[model samples]
Every structure is written in structure tokens, then in C-alpha cells.
Target: MGTISPIKESTCCDPASAGTVYLPSGTSLILLMPRLLATTIHGAVDVLKKTFDGTYDDNCPACGETHAHGGICCGIPEIHCPSPCVCSIHWVGCPGDSFKHAIQVTNTSKTEREFTLTSVPFPHTQEAVAVTPGKQTLGTEESLQAEASFTIPETFAGSKYRTVIKVKGAYEQIIQVCLTVRPRQACGCHVEQGDIPKRVKAHHWYHHFQCVEDCFEPAKKVG
Candidate 1:
């Protein structure tokens, strides 16, 4: 008859939230682990809070509040900056005179705060969208303005020009200005000293230029 012997068994385990940790079962170590350790929330919730954050019905309600500022990421009482506002496009003109447009960037914060405008998508030449005055500081009940202008050239006498105006730091706001130049027909070759010229020249040139070297010759022979 074979003798029965006690078999050696391995240790046991209880999962943890942040990461896996070996704890001696039935000891004080089991009580110390957080309740959410085994769940997916333990491994990813903190990472979600760290990058590419946004707010809608249950998130921060403002811009730049997620990355720059710290907040608790929960299902309720969404996180966001205290103040939120936006700049927008107001007007666009067609070929009429010159390109011109304006904008008003406001501060919605009730408390005093400072902001520095750093733009990558500017309205001109695909350059860094930057504030005209540079390193601006706005307080409560304050605003900023910007404008664009372009003169009409003689060649494009009746042509239109478009000017894009975008606010710095505020990516959403954009404006396009249209300046229409009145039409100016070319000088009348027929008119001489402010007199009827093209009226008479066009008449002769149309047929005269077409007839070429033999224009008057053929008429002379017929006459």
C-alpha cells in the first residue's frame, strides 16, 4: 500500500488597481490594496486625464484647461476653466474698394487672469499667427482688436482682393475682408487731349489694322 503525503501548493492572489503586485494572501497585505485594482479603470483612468482631454456633457467646459491645469476626472461635475469665450468672423466684402475687417477678442473670466497669444496658423502667408502688439495681457472686462487693409492696383482696376484675419491663441475666430476696385477701361486710342478718340480710332483700327499694308492701297485702286 502507498503512503499518502501532504502535497505542496502555491500562493494565492487579489488584483490591484494601478498595477499588478504580489501580496501574501491572508496577511495584512490583502487589506491594503485598493478596491478597484482588478478593473480596467485602474490601469487607464489616470492616463486619460493626462493627455488629449476634452469636455462635453461630462467634461471640462473650457479650452486649455485640461493640459495646463490639473483636475479630477470623474463621471460628474465636469472639469474646465472657469471662463470660456470665442471670437468669430463678422464680415466679408466683394470687389468694391479696399480690404478691411476688424475683430473683438474678449476675456470671459470674472477674476483677473493673464494670457499670451501664440498662434501657429496665422491669417497671412501661412506664418505663425501672432499678436500684433505681442505678449498681451488682458484682465476682466477687457478686449483686443485687429484690422487688415490693402490698396487696389491700376492693372486690376475692378478686381477684388481677399484678406484673412484670425485671432491669436483663439483658433476658432477668422475673418475675410473684400475690397472691390471700380472698373477702369483702357484709355481710348482714338481720343486725343480728352476728346473723342477710341470712338473714331476703334472704327478705323478695327478695319485698318485688319487690312494691313494694303488697306489704303486697295481702296486707292478702286477709287
Candidate 2:
């Protein structure tokens, strides 16, 4: 145990000393602020791993497509760890005519804390499907571990998916985890920089007409 260095003028302890000083559960409420640590600790490498060696035994082989191809269903997006690890979706081969897929997230926070996950697709979402438990009291036990999981969706109708993890610790520091998704299906119609509109203004009349007349011109820009 470490003693908090005292401050002047006030009898109360400093906010920076909160992490070291023991506090009751829920007493250590973290204010989600931009930055509290004046001395920024470079984020650790985020990592993701799956222990699904035998989770799904009957599901068919995962569709290789990145996006929905009509009848096939894909796993959800996931993220993990702040450093020393990479997060993404993974597919594993299973027994005859079966396989498993998962979104693995990992954290590299040296300090133990609570983690919450949410997404725009499920805006009203509230709850922590995954989290790392804190350590036991001093002279007791010090555990080192992190937690997260694959959040299943109700439907696969979304064009894309994204999720975020908000980590709040006794130190009052907050971190974010952003997970991005990609569709499996390839674009039937190629898009080029020229095809994209800018400034949100009306495009040239002649250019718009020419595009309808000779759409091939735009395709050239794609290549």
C-alpha cells in the first residue's frame, strides 16, 4: 500500500490519489472526460482471441463472403485490448459440414477496471456483456486479466456495423475501442473518385448528361 502525498489548503486528498486509496464500490464513479492523466501513457496494442475450438458443432461452414449473399449469416464485429493485440472477426473450420466464427476483443490496460460495450445499430443498448474483474485487496491477491465477447445481433439487415467500448477506472481515465466492419460481397458496379460528389453542390449539367450517355467514362476512373 502507498500513502497519498498530502496537498495544501484543503484537508481532503487529491483527485490523482483516488486510484491508490481504497474506496467503496460505486464510490469511484469515473467522469467520462477527454483526458485526466497529464502524463499520457501510450496505449497498449489491442488483441483478440477465440477459444471456439468446439462451440458451434452444427452450424454450416461459414460463408466466405464479407457481406450477406442472400441466405448466409455472418458473425458480428468485435474489438479488444488497447495494445500488443489486434482485434477482428475470425472463422474456424469445424467437424463435417460445420464451422464457427467469432469476434474477439482484448485489452492491454495495466490497470484493472470496468468495461461497457455499445453500438449505433443498437443505440438504446445498456449493459456489459464482457468485463475484467478487479483484483483482491492488498496483501491478498493481484490478478491480471481482461474480458470481452461477441455481441450477437437480432437481424443481419444492417449495411454495416460498428461498436464501442467505454472503460472507466478508479484513476478516472477513460478509453475507447472502435470496431469496424466490411461487407463480404464485392461491388457489382465499380466506383471512382470522379463518381463521388463534393461540396454538396449541383454537379455540372453537361457532366451529368454525359455520364448517362457514356457511363464507361466513370468506370475508367475506377481502374
Candidate 3:
């Protein structure tokens, strides 16, 4: 018998020599596919739920209403005030009562800054709203407590008043102040007797009466 030649071993190229070899085998890919698919489906479901659930920031807290995309809450314009600024303040008091609140101001910048606080009264109303510490200087990252006070006039019973307190510095801030003057005496009816329109047209009488009755029901408890 002829002697068999020694078998030559074949040499394979190194994976690094081939440049950027993907080592995952078909079985590895199959194992990973289900995990990738499940992850994608979970992300999609989350997006859909948030879109339809009205959990976005534009929903109004006061009215439980949602506005169009990028719209402000309750359709109110966005207040371009600083984070420390108090955007709104509300108070309810009987006539001749005084109310006070504290507004916090901060110097958000790196350097010292001066600020001025001014109260702008609503047109045609003599609401006695005042902001103290009208002018102040704050150091870097320092904060100040400003006072806002209002005294309801004796003649201002059963009325609503609004005033704006403005803070001017490196930037401007606005605080809306609202005062509700409670009636001294009850109207004796569920609906406020004074608010009823005396001479409504026959066709519109029902609507007018209904509106007055529904709107004034809460006022009965104020006194």
C-alpha cells in the first residue's frame, strides 16, 4: 500500500483581520429578537396611553380641561415670570376686613441685583392692594420676603376686585391678586335677589334666571 500523504490543516483568517466581524450566531439573533420586539411594543403602548390619557402638562387643574398642544392651562396666557414668583393670590373677606400675604423674591443670578415691586390697581376700582418692600437689593442666590396687603372697603361688599403686583429687576415678574368681598347679609333665597334682571325679554327670561340662580348658589354660603 502507498503511504498516505500527511493531511494539511486549513488556516482560517482571524476575526480581527477581517475587520468588524459580527460574532452573534443565528441562534443568538433568534434569542434576542423576542426581547427587542417586546421592548418596542412596551414603549409604543406607553406612548399611546399618555397621548390618550390627558396626562400632559397642558391640562388645567382648576377646570379639569385640556387645551391644544403647547397651549397654556385653561387657555390663559403663560406668565413669563421667574420660578420664585407667585403667579396668583386669592382672598375672600367680608367688607372692611384686611388680608395680607407674603411674596418670596430671589436673586437667581450670580451677582447682586436690585428689584422693585409695584402694585397696579384694576381700572375703575379703588382696591386697596399694596406691596411692601417696594424696592430691595439681593445678593447672589439670596431671597427676600415681600408683603402684600389689601383692605376691603366697607362699600365694596358683594364685589370682586383684581390687582397686579409687578416685580422689576434683571427680569420682570407678575403676581395677580384677587379679592372677593362677601355680602354682609344673605339674599334670603337660593339665588341672589339683587342679581335677578328685572326686565328680561319673555323669550330670554328663563335663560337669564337660570344663569343667575346657578351662578349665585355658592354665594349663599359666603355670608
Candidate 4:
């Protein structure tokens, strides 16, 4: 038979401590050591706060506001600066006249934003293109319309040309504008000019070097 050992009083399970104590009558006993723990309401709250960051109803980290024009993502507010408010013009012409269009820019941010507009002219171009109010500042949720003009030179005779309009600053956008030159029909006549009386011929369905008396009219009148 095995002999049983008695438990020491000093080593007994204490009610103040967190542990389990068991006695096997006059046989054996088992004991489990207690584990210490320290926690407070403030500590628990901090843990919860870290777990649910940027949840709904929380302030935005980017703009430091509860709401923004664009929704929040990853605790950051969406910035909508220099967003284009205008649509691109595919083709513009007025038959020996100038073309003009309106371009709108919007600043959806909560603060002011700077903007600049410039044009990229193509090679072998004779017309002059420009933008009005090219550079300016915009306020929150504010918008501005810039006028774009393209003057067709009398010497312009190309079928079409493309110009790239660029807006730079807080935001950026590239708008492509295509301009077409009106075609001039053949007048089926000849013109004499210059010191030597240069003569110009009219090709089939094409304009002559010089304008004729009845170049573009209902009835043909040679002069």
C-alpha cells in the first residue's frame, strides 16, 4: 500500500487566490497554481477603441471632419480637388470663323485649391488657341468656367487638327479638343493678280488660291 502525505497549511489553497485545491481523504491531494491578472475599465476601453477605428460616426483623419464631399476610406477623407466639371468637345468649326467653348473646373475639397490651364498645340498649326482665366484659386465646393477659344486663320486649310488642354494643380486632367477646317468648294473659274498677272486654277471640289467673284453662291459668275 502507498503512503499518503499531508498538505502544509502555509501551502494550502487560499480563498484570496485564484486556484483549485482537492484532497483525496487520507490518500493524496492535488493543487493548481493561481495566475495573476491586472486590468481596468480604462485599459479595456482603449483596446476596444483600437479595434474599431474609423467606424461610422467617427471623425475623418484627412479633413478632421465627421463628413466630407466624398466618402471616407481607411480613416481618410476623399479629396476632390481640380475635378473637371466640363465635357470634351470632339469637333468644332464655323466655316471661316472662330470656335469657342466653355470649360468648368470644380474644387470639392473643404479648402482652397489652385489651378492652372494650358494648351498643347500640334505641329504645322496656324490657328491660335487660348484659355481665359487660365490660372486661379477655387474655394470649397466652388466651380469656375474657363473660356477656350480657337481662331481659324484665313490661311488654314487643313482637314483637322487636335489640341490638348491640360489643367494642373491640386488635381489634374487632360482634355482633347479636335478642330476641323471647313472645306471650300471649287468655283470653276480663274483669277489674275500680282505684277505679272498670276493666274490661279480651280481644282475639282476644292478652293482656288484666290477668291472668285461667285466663289460660294447659288449662281456662277466669272470675273
Clashes of each: 10, 19, 0, 0
Q: lDDT of each prediction vs. the true structure?
A: 0.44, 0.36, 0.76, 0.66
**Tens-digit per-residue lDDT, 131-153, candidate 4:** 99898899987887899887666
lDDT for 207 in candidate 2 is 60
Ranking by TM-score: 3, 4, 1, 2
lDDT, candidate 2, at 51: 19
How far residue 61's Cα lies from its native spot in candidate 3, in Å, is 25
What does candidate 1's lDDT look like per residue over 72-177, in tens digits?
Answer: 4433445655322343333222233344434456766775554444334322334222234434557787876644344343444544444444443433344444
Q: TM-score of every model?
A: 0.29, 0.23, 0.45, 0.42
Please, what are the lDDT tens digits per residue for candidate 2 over residues 1-223? 9999877675887878878956555533453233344224323211111113332233445743343223445566466545522343332211121222333233345554443332222244442234344222222133334444444333322234334443333332222333222232321356566443433344588666322234334534554
lDDT score, candidate 1, position 105: 60
State which candidate has the highest lDDT. 3
Query: Which consecutive 10 residues in model 2 have the weakest lDDT in total?
Result: 42-51
* Candidate 1 accuracy as TM-score: 0.29
Candidate 2 ranges with C-alpha deviation above 4 Å: 1-122, 126-129, 132-143, 154-164, 183-223
Model 1 regions more than 4 Å off = 1-102, 110-135, 186-223
* Candidate 3 per-residue C-alpha lDDT over 1-223 given as tens digits, one digit per residue, 9 for 90 to 100: 9999999999997777777656888898888989899999999999888777655446565645576544555544555644745689999888767889998888989989999998987668665478888899999989888999887777777878777888888877788888877787841236445653443233465554432224334545654
Flag clash pairs in model 3.
Answer: none
